[model samples]
Target: MKKRWLCLFVENEVGVLARITGLFSAKAYNLNSLTVGTTQDETASRVTISLFSDDQLFEQIKKQLNRMVEVFKVIDYTDIDIYRKEIMFLKILKCTENDRTFLFQFSEVYGIRILDFNKDSVLIESIKAEEENNLMLQLLYKRLDNPVEIVRGGSVAVEAV
Candidate 1:
């Protein structure tokens, strides 16, 4: 199976997001990432979804989404030139001075930001491609022994102009 992406333009109405996600759940499609936000039109929303599936399954998913009344358009992004990013906030607890210095150096090298810090904890933010964020998380896990908290804002994408 290969990764696929879809951008769905749908009516911005109550239950629209639920209905769309429900479709995936009902069909047992595994979603890798999903993000939704209102478009400039305000009356509509753009939903970005990423999943891993075979070509046939991906085609079927697009067809099913197109059949939804709320969906105005379903753009397949599988082979498109697009800019995509995922935001993640990682907090490290019980950080020592050396640990914080190490984290700052790591962040500088990776283009991550040190968002905030206190005496014992530091919060950092990473906005990058999903795969890059995943790799950062893996490296952090290997380096940090303190309690860690992570929150990721799924992914958003726009077609390259």
Candidate 2:
């Protein structure tokens, strides 16, 4: 299976999101990430979805999406050289003094923006390529004492040169 990021443009109407998601759920397809919001055209919305499936299944998914009444267009970025990135907000809930020092150093190296901090936890926001998110989480897991909470803002992309 391969990872695919698809952008779906649909009518900005009630239950449209639900219907689209329902299609995936009903088919037992795995949706890894989803982000939906209105576009400049307030009448329409852009829904970005990331999923893991083989090439054949991916084609079927696209056809199904296009058949939906609400969908205006579908943009599949799986094979395109595009500028893709996902936003991640990580909250390091627990760590030692040594861990804190290491985190600060890591922040400096990675250019992480400190969103909040207190005696118990530290929050930082970052935007990076999809694969980079995994690498960043790995480093945090190795250093942090407790499980980290992560909020992923699904990937957005544009055409690259």
Best model per TM-score: 1
Task: Work out the TM-score per prediction.
Answer: 0.96, 0.92
Over 57-132, each residue of candidate 2 has an lDDT whose tens digit, in order, gives 9999999999999999999988888887899998887766676677778888987887877776778888998788
20-127 per-residue lDDT for model 1 (tens digits): 999999999999999999999999999999999999999889999999999999999989899999999999999999889999999999999999998899999999
Name the weakest run of 10 consecutive residues (lDDT summed) in model 1. 135-144
How many clashing residue pairs are found in candidate 2? Answer: 0
> Residue 36 deviation, candidate 2, in Å?
0.8
Local distance difference test values of all predictions, in order: 0.95, 0.87
Q: Best lDDT goes to which candidate?
A: 1
Stretches of model 2 off by over 4 angstroms after superposition: none
